[model samples]
Target: MILVTGATGQLGTAVLDNLLQHTPAQQVAALVRDEAKAATWQAQGVSIRVGHYGDPASLDRAMQGIEKVLLISGGGEDDALQQHYHVIDAAKKAGVRCLAYTSRALKDPSSLANHLMVRHFQTEEYLQASGLPHIIFRNILYMDTLPLFTGPTVLETGISLPGGQGRVAYALRSEMGEAIAKVLLAGTCDNRIYHFTGAEAYSFTDVAAALTELSGRQVAYTDVENEVLAGRMRERGVPEVAIERTIGFMTDIKHGQEDIVSSDLATALGRQPASLVEGVKLLYKL
Candidate 1:
């Protein structure tokens, strides 16, 4: 069986949906924290396993006879590391033959935002030492944080923190999930570490232009310093920890740290990924 952790989430759901196209629904299982949230998946004939990163016992039960598990990185609190360890331990005990983990693109373990990737490395270590075949996909940044992105509440404030023109090889989260689904069902590619990325490169300036075209407005890019940006967010009531990390990572990327593009994602899936133009049309309903 193939098990997808965090199946109720956006990333996990994309994987589940794509996997259904490549494999039978009955052969798949959605490992979600809330069974109630998965009524549609259950009604569609896919097995629903109630589980959470915080609950090792539930993960154990969910992985009873599973051969492959996709450990989606859990988001929240200082305990994310501990909760991930619990899930990894359970997967080991269950004797799953293969495991795939969603991780960020961190070439340097000593980089500023490498803390998150470090945890993924820890999970990779557990999988390696446990004699379980594994695949670690160090993914590039998501394109969802584009210039046109806006929630109902945030749209009123207009665009914020429009950085001073830096290029990021931002891969679509859907493409990442599709690649994961492809690997899971292929039943090969064991003990392989892959770098998932998009085909083309783009800058925030390009993103702003696209947003102006899509939204048909006079939106423009605005650059600000790290400290001033953080202060503004703090004054607006954003959480301190989140604000700090957000600025840190953006600063890391802005200075040409995240400018490279790779073909690993295309090579793994045997096809090209969506370009920024394509991604925006789909995401922005344009």
Candidate 2:
């Protein structure tokens, strides 16, 4: 059976949805911390394995009877790196035939965004050393997060960020999940890395133009200074950690760190992923 960790999360849920379309529910298992949250999946014939990334014993139990595993990256947890290590170690011990990990599509190790991706780099290294057959997916920024970056009143306030002329190759999180599910179902590990990114890179100015066309509003782009954007976020009561992260992301963009583009996602899906304009429409419901 194939198992997916963080099955209740957005990307994990999307992967499960795609997986169920091509495979029987009985062939799939969900690794969740809370079984109660996965009651619907359990009712649908998916084996619900209760486990925590931080708990090796629980992971061991969850790994039972599972030939393949998808280790979804943890979110915002302080000990997420250690938790990933635990899961990798357990998967190794269980002798899983293949393991897949979701990592970031970052090219520059010295970028300010390294603060966010250092753990992913470490996890990738650890996974490589674990001697388990593995496929590493280096995913780019999610179009799903564009709304968070743009804010609710983006149409009214225009697009304002510290990201200068830098562009990002943003792909939909659900599409990435679909591609990942395809790889999982293909049952090939091959110890290869795939850079899951959109076909083209786009700047905030491009986003503003797309919003203007889609919304019929004259949306504009404003590249503010780093401190200026941080001050605005502070005024909005955004948390310090989040503000720091946002600044780091913008700084990385300014340095062209997120401009990498690749065709791996399209090759996996057998079709082109959504364009920036298309993604913006889906995100805004326009």
> For each candidate, what TM-score against the reference?
0.89, 0.98
How would you encode candidate 2's per-residue C-alpha lDDT over 67-124 as one tens digit per residue? Answer: 9999999977899999999999999999999999999887686555639678888899
lDDT of 1 by residue, 1-286 (tens): 8989999998999999998898888889989878999998899888999978898889889998788889898885578878877877888898888888887775555665525546766666766776767888888878876632332323234445635565678888888888888878889846888888788667666665666677676555556677877777788798888776677567656655566678988976788988877786777776
Model 1 compared with the native: what TM-score? Answer: 0.89
RMSD of each: 2.6, 0.9
* Residue pair clashes in candidate 1: none
Total clashes in model 2, counting residue pairs 3 or more apart in sequence or in different chains: 0
Cα displacement (Å) at residue 277, model 1: 2.1
Top candidate when judged by lDDT against the true structure = 2
